[model samples]
Target chain A: MSATESPASTPLLAVNNIEVIYDHVILVLKGVSLAVPEGGIVALLGANGAGKTTTLKAVSNLLGAERGDVTKGAIHFRGERVDQLTPAELVRRGVVQVMEGRHCFAHLSIEENLLTGAYTQALSRSELRDALERVYHYFPRLKERRASQAGYTSGGEQQMCAIGRAIMARPAMILLDEPSMGLAPQIVEQIFEIVKDLNVRERISFLLAEQNTMVALRYADFGYILENGRVVMEGSAQALGSNEDVKEFYLGLASEGRKSFRDARSYRRRKRWLA
Target chain B: MELIFFFEVLVGGLLAGIMYSLVALGFVLIYKASGVFNFAQGAMVFFAALAFVSFQSWGWPFPLALLAALATMIVVALATERVVLRKLVNQPPITLFMATIGLTFVLEGLAQLIFGTDVHRLELGIPDDPLEIQGMLISTFDLIAAGVAALLVVALGVFFQYTRVGRALRAVADDHQAALSIGIPLQHIWAIVWAVAGFVALVAGLLWGARLGVQFALTLVALKALPVLILGGFTSVPGAIVGGLIIGASEKLAEVYVGPFVGGGIENWFAYVLALGFLLVRPEGLFGERHIDRV
Candidate 1:
């Protein structure tokens, strides 16, 4: 997997043979394996407590601090072993995570929050100032409110700030945990649109862990369904979106009514709901 | 008996206040980086004075003795970081505070064990002649001490504001995890802050030692820092200096004017009383930002 992630078609991140145990007794992730190809958004779909956040933490190597031990397994990013590295080291290497909650330094100005994103990058003062100007281009709302303290921002703005902070690292890949967890539908759409834009324009890979299966699967190129700490299903986003079992369980469609719709042959053929 | 005598007392008090600020800066540096209220800071001052005196009396030139004393303080800071503080890094703040209290005892015993309990005079290499400025009779030593204190404060400010390490220290103060995530090494920053704190303590020791010879009594002067820290915010550099000046002046004046009303020893409680009054008005201190944590 590491060797195949070439400059042309490298999987941005590959998680293989990973196991996470809490306190040596209770196991959270049991040998979860997944790969996110470059220039694609892959959603790790699961319900609450399905270890989606843990999987993201394991990939970022941030679980060791919380007694969530990655007992075995390796995470490779841009064809380099990244499993044992600390979060600080990972940030430097460009595998930044936005985390579950926004976790912006609330007391800091919006500008300071962004500067912290480029914390590991030793850029000249003029270069840092220029990079900050570029960040404001993506999230213009943030630019308008740059001098304001982060705590005063709305939840949606805070989420934007969080993503902007990760972008400041100029990461090749980003792990987003519950980016739309508590946002309103309108805000969720806005955040997802920004994510899509980032993926399409910047060519940055994204591995998003989300409970909102409908919204996540809609935008993702590939999808992995995690249940009870294991990958119960993996396929291209289109295939998983139309699978019978996925429709019944993930999309919350009543099994009795959409029995035929469950086995969608193609996105165009599944037109009953569209009509 | 008149207003002229009161003016004299006021001037002396102000000089004392500046000295107190120098001592308080040591606590501020250590606390900002490590979040540990260092009880050993006072002991560090005493030890620094002892080193200075030992070097001068041992036939070293004045400049050489000063350098040797500073080097000793640095060694002490490094040793404290490697031995005592390294072990207590992740411990709770209370536990770390207690460890510092233990450090105070160890340092006191070590100083006594090495230098003995006898008092030693400290000559700051300045002329003992008095200078008359606008009819105020000022000792050259007091003026020099105050000047040294001002210069050190400015140097520390520059070191923290302009240097890479200084920015790293500020990041640590803001959020340790965030700082670490950015690869600002915690252990390295801790060692640097302690070394700088040790340097400040040595300067403070030299000044105080000149006023009252290097003895065990010098260690007790560290108690004066508590008020400075309380009145000035613990994390604030300028606050510490300002708080120290306020406490130093008021206490000296209180000991003279107010002490007559109530027996004597008003200096012993005057600083505390001032701090208590400040706390009642603003518990976060004069310059401390209001810090409220959410559950």
Candidate 2:
């Protein structure tokens, strides 16, 4: 089914042509839209300042906190119009976001940081313990350093903690932003493996905003490429991964071979999709 | 004999320091959760005390009066969150601080307008009689107040460390945007913190009212908490306690030991002087989190 027609199936989350403006003047997102199917991983691929984070924040209803407002369009989660709901209300409805840069509570222990995710759940003691064990099962490194302050943990561990913390919320969907940012390639691959595992086992959907296009396209079921606050191109992961333009512009691969810095700088000005 | 006298002064100062911690605790709660240095905390103390006394004067029973006053503080907290803070989300911290300074005046004015300016003596049935222990005298009222403060500190400590809501509060304190994205309701957390701060204000109000009478001057006691916050770190509960104790003991000791040479009344300014010196040495305070930027 086409992206437009998929909304009739009531996908997990649907962002319909939303426009976001910050400070009521600076327009950040213009007529951007995407959908994450239930139990599917969708990648929001873009360079920096391409409105990937803004789109995720729009779906999570977190833009308001940063003086950004959705000036137009609607966001539906599980067929309910949730554009106006508070972020906590959205979480209660099983939508949580792992913000970029591993925003772990520095002073709190890893366990405490995870527990904060379950704040709205009101789980019993045993249930809470079960949730922690479940998260630890996926990220054993977190289990080993559960008592340590999150600030002192390594970059990869903090990323795991951020995702683990979201898992503790028992969310139906998680808006994962920049999970691969600043992490080594091996660590990024490991995180994607756990994310795929969680998707398969727990049936959790993910709308991931990632600048690491090559790795994200490898794992995501579908992908949308955003540029200058607009979706320029979108397709199944296989299609986007193999597309020549995507390989040239994003992965630095050309018809001949890997492009040098001079050729790559000129490649952006020759984006056929923008034309 | 001299040693015995010094111990008495030290003990007295320590107990009085607990009172300062009580008021400072309210400031810490609001500051930690919202990053707003609530200048209105002093006014909240005065307002709660005045409300309690006013309710009692209306022929309500003591427990009933206390409950009503507690409810009033909760209302004040909710209103403040809804009206003032809800409008100022994402504003700079200085803007919020300035708003609270405006709030302080409004609360003080409202308290006077509602409860009248009359100074009413609050009798909590705790006698002010001195109890002697090995030739050193201690006030029974001070002992009971210190005990109450200790109980409060323990209860607050448990609430913060052991509860789900407590974890959310700390998370929000660390980062607002992240907390919100994770579905920790920023508004609810702010309201809860303010309500808890209001509750702390009530306890402090009642105790200070009984000791010094419920009057306009009771608002000035919040100034004493300033030195306590400076010493303990504005974000740490134990810091408030230790800060208060040091400020209390040294000030009293300074008044007694150094008063003859300096012509007395050094007790009032000694805490500030010490806090200033402390600021130069450790600006973050003893328990305040040291901010380290990783570049």
Candidate 3:
């Protein structure tokens, strides 16, 4: 089936014909377009320097820092134009980016770092107390180490803290950039499980950028293939899994050496004519 | 012969400590709000006091002079933020520190150019009569200074704890990026911090100027605040007060008793020595969080 007309047809976010240039000269993302359905996990798979992370950043309006300029096209969130809004304003609208490298404030305590996630919420002191309790429910390990400084936590713990901090904002969607980068295979599995749980339970959409194709397809219901800053192919997870061409190129399994079931048909036709 | 005198010195030291806390409070406010060390604090104090003196000299009532002086300090603060600090934002912290030092020189030059480089008496509005409290003689000015400092502390505490804007300021102190993400107007919060810092400096200036004639020497009192910040922790409000009191009282006692043996100037190094000892004991200062790192 065509990617646009699957069971997940309703586009919660639409990136319409976007072009991003760097420093008014270098063209990084060349006219890329994609859509994410509500409560759906969309995986954008690409090699390094394919503008995958840049596309995610563009959606969050966090491109200016990396010298990325959206020269053309726009990103629509919840049927509203969101490309013009600043990153902070976009965050208020429930679009949170769990940036790569797990940026947690090292000097602050874990509890303090979590509180910072609710920076935009105008909750009462009692309500904030309740929210804190809710966060501890999801991350009991953090609760145990709440008073401890964030720097003392392990990499996996820091990643958890980063995710928990983003969740504290009560985001409707989270753009996870390389969530499993530099993690152990065991830890990666656990992290992906948590991501799925968050999506299923909280109904939060996820746009994940990852290099692990098999792992991504294992969890993602739908996926997009990005090549050289463009969406080359997109389809349901199962169709893309079985596509012969996709296997040859992306799945690292080539059909070039395999014989086609065609020469036998010609030989039978010739024998029938002789009879 | 010496015991009675020692008790007298001790009482005097405690009172002086309270006064030092008042001055240190100004440093704490600015440092916490903007992360600017604000070396120009002493100049703000001098200018505020000078303005008050000028108003009083013009035959204005004491309350009128105080009100006018406060108004002037606010204006100065607004101007400083707009002209100097606003321009310096996003610069390196060291660059900003250097800018403040330059500001100190400019303000001193301006004060000298305008008010002349000489001492002028600042008449304390309170009656200049001494009061006897438990066989100790307390000058009315000391009582008034202490009372005013207490009021300042309480009011600041209320503002920080209860007000929305004050909470935003605290958030800014804790994390600037997070504060901006929350839509806290960075410029407005910074301006407010400066205004509050100016107000604190004015109070300290007036009290110190009244105690020892309005002159550049009153600016020197800001030096004592450094040790208070060091001992109390750079970011703690209560630490500033406690640090100040320790510095003030110990310096008073040291000058009184250890002066003969050390050939005087014990007051100059008393706060530093105390700070050194405190650092040796608790490197993070009294109220600062203990820093830890993971491998």
Q: What is the lDDT of residue B138 in candidate 3?
A: 66
For model 1, state the Cα shift of residue A157 in Å.
4.0
Ranking by TM-score: 2, 1, 3
Worst 10 residues of 3 chain A by lDDT: A1-10
User: If you assessed candidate 2 against the hidden native complex, which CAPRI class would it receive?
Assistant: medium
- Write the residue-wise lDDT of candidate 2 on A204-248 in tens digits: 999999999999999999899999888888888999999998988
Q: lDDT tens digits, residues A1-275, model 1? A: 22233223557788886899987998999888888888889999987887899998898766765667888888888778888887778888878888777776666678877876776787889988887887888889999889887777888888888888888888878899899978999999999999999999888889999999989999999888887787777787899889976787678785577645436445423432342
| Candidate chain B TM-scores, in order | 0.94, 0.99, 0.92
Give the DockQ of candidate 3: 0.19
Candidate 2 vs candidate 3, DockQ winner:
2
lDDT of every model, 2 decimals: 0.82, 0.92, 0.78
Write one digit per residue (lDDT tens) for candidate 3, span B105-165: 8877887777677688987767767777666666777767878888888899888755666
TM values, all candidates: 0.84, 0.97, 0.74
DockQ of each: 0.26, 0.78, 0.19
| Winner by lDDT | 2
The full ranking of all candidates by DockQ, starting with the best, is 2, 1, 3
Model 2 TM-score (2 dp):
0.97
Q: Considering every candidate listed, which one attains the maximal TM-score?
A: 2
Q: Model 2, residue A29: displacement in angstroms?
A: 1.3
Cα lDDT, model 3, residue A102 = 72
